[model samples]
Target: MKSNYFFRSIHAMRGLASFAVLISHSLTLYPFFEFRAAAAGVDIFFVISGIVMCLAIEEDTSKLDFIKKRIIRVVPLYWIATGLSVAYIYARYPHMSHSWDWIIRSFLFLPQQPGVDMPILYTGWSLNYEMFFYLILFLSLFIFKNAPIAAACIVAMIASFSAVGNLISYNYFFKQIFIEFSLGILIGYFLKFGGRVEKNLGIFLIFLALVIFFIHNKFASSGFLAWGVPSAMLILGAISFENSELFKRNFVKIFGDASYSLYLVHPLVIWGIEWYVLPEHRGILQVAIAIAISIFISIIFYKWVEKPLMRFLSKNL
Candidate 1:
């Protein structure tokens, strides 16, 4: 089956975001240099999710059909990753106790309450926000026919709720991140209604550089601005440079195809390395080794697990 050029472009962007996160984590593990800017990768992913989900819904399809397709796309791989991570945690830390309710909440992708130990797959926390975004988007479709209006409303509601939730309680990770996903929806609306962003090579390069500088300076100081500003700029860059040669290589496309798997599985690989290989090592060399191991493991997981699942879903579902 052939995918559209637009979808392929989104896939390529996902790959870039995943690699950015990898670099960020590696730098964080070391002492001398810190590149917290990498965390903006998740913000980019959320935006891409919003754009792609809206695009998918633009086709003539019933709500049930839309829900089914999403479930098939997200649930199978998510559950597999969750289950493995939980088992790994249990095996590694046999004395660590967790409640059955916490397990249930994580598995169900429900909003985790404060003081609960997050799931073993630390990155799985993002999936909860993604599921929440889906729920909001699904409900909005019934109340509003205009996709852009619906997306804008969703973004505003999430932002308002996030601000209130943060004020009430200090711990609001889920609420805060959900806003990033909604921002993506707003971007999608812009893409649909505002027409293509005009591309000027020089201006695009300048915007990209400014985005990097902004993310690097702000990520360590301000969590909200770190992801929010750079994510917006990244999406704008992506849409404007859709046909650019910067990301049109075969290897890049392959990485993009496997990015979801890499994102879901890399934490486990990192944890395993920390547990067995580098428990005492905090050197830059150890950081490089950790990153290399993660990339190797993620590549295998992507090729064997993620690619096959997506292919099966596309063909059978």
Candidate 2:
């Protein structure tokens, strides 16, 4: 039950999630409303990261290798994006200044300052949580060989501590988002190791979650359960086609490979367009232009910069 290679469905899910986030950001200029809920993509990503860590441990991976790969996968691109974000902020607000300490902490994947949500790169806020989760998984490697029990324990601890330590200073930065990762791990545990996941049940969860999303989209909810649990269900249903030929199509080619690039590149592209190209004319057309250019640039950066850097570091290290 615990054996399988790469799942195209998972990769495809990454592509879809990243695209959803990109769309959400592009809707920033809309006057009537903002598509902030598309940020459920981040929740989706959190769950995905948890599942990935679970998969890594199940593969009998070395803990050091797991950590090393995560660092390599995350750090270089994040640093570059941080540098770009700093430049963008300086240009956009010539008088506004970022704290040097915050910049350093951002690069280190540390939590944001009290009551602050975003980092230098804005989107890099999630990376802070990602790094923290990786730290847990790496340490958990010493004790738990299986992903399920470890995931259960993590979920319980987060729930218990959150209830008791709601006033803790750190909670300002940490919040309750940790549950998304735990949800993902539980899904991974159930699908990969524990037993069969019925297709009908997956379908029902997907439909029920969509209803929740639709309602939340109109009224807007604030809790992780509103977003995170739905995201987990989406992944649960999506990965049901993991072994199928669905994601291998040329047009649907796995943008999952470029997903990180998309995540880091789209905001810069969107902001640049808003600043330089069309400040006054904010409409659907403007969003179209931004998304087109962003995807193009992200692919280019992925091919020329990120891929080469990763390849070089993988070989050298």
Per-model TM values vs. the true structure: 0.86, 0.90
Which ten residues in a row are the worst by lDDT in model 1? 1-10
Per-residue CA lDDT of candidate 2, range 96-182, in tens? 766887888888988767776678787898888788778778777777866445754776477556666556757743456777778
The ten-residue window of minimal lDDT in model 2 covers: 1-10
User: How big is the positional error of residue 106 in model 1, measured in Å on the Cα after superposition?
Assistant: 1.4
The reply for model 2, stretches above 4 Å from the true place, is: 1-3, 31-34, 144-148, 164-166, 194-198, 277-279
The segments of candidate 1 whose C-alpha lies over 4 angstroms from its true place after superposition are 1-8, 165-176, 205-219, 313-317
Q: Pairing residues by index, what is the TM-score of model 2? A: 0.90
Candidate 1 lDDT, 158-191, residue by residue in tens: 5666666445664444355556666766676666
- Name the top lDDT candidate: 2
lDDT of 2: 0.77
Clashing pairs in 1: none
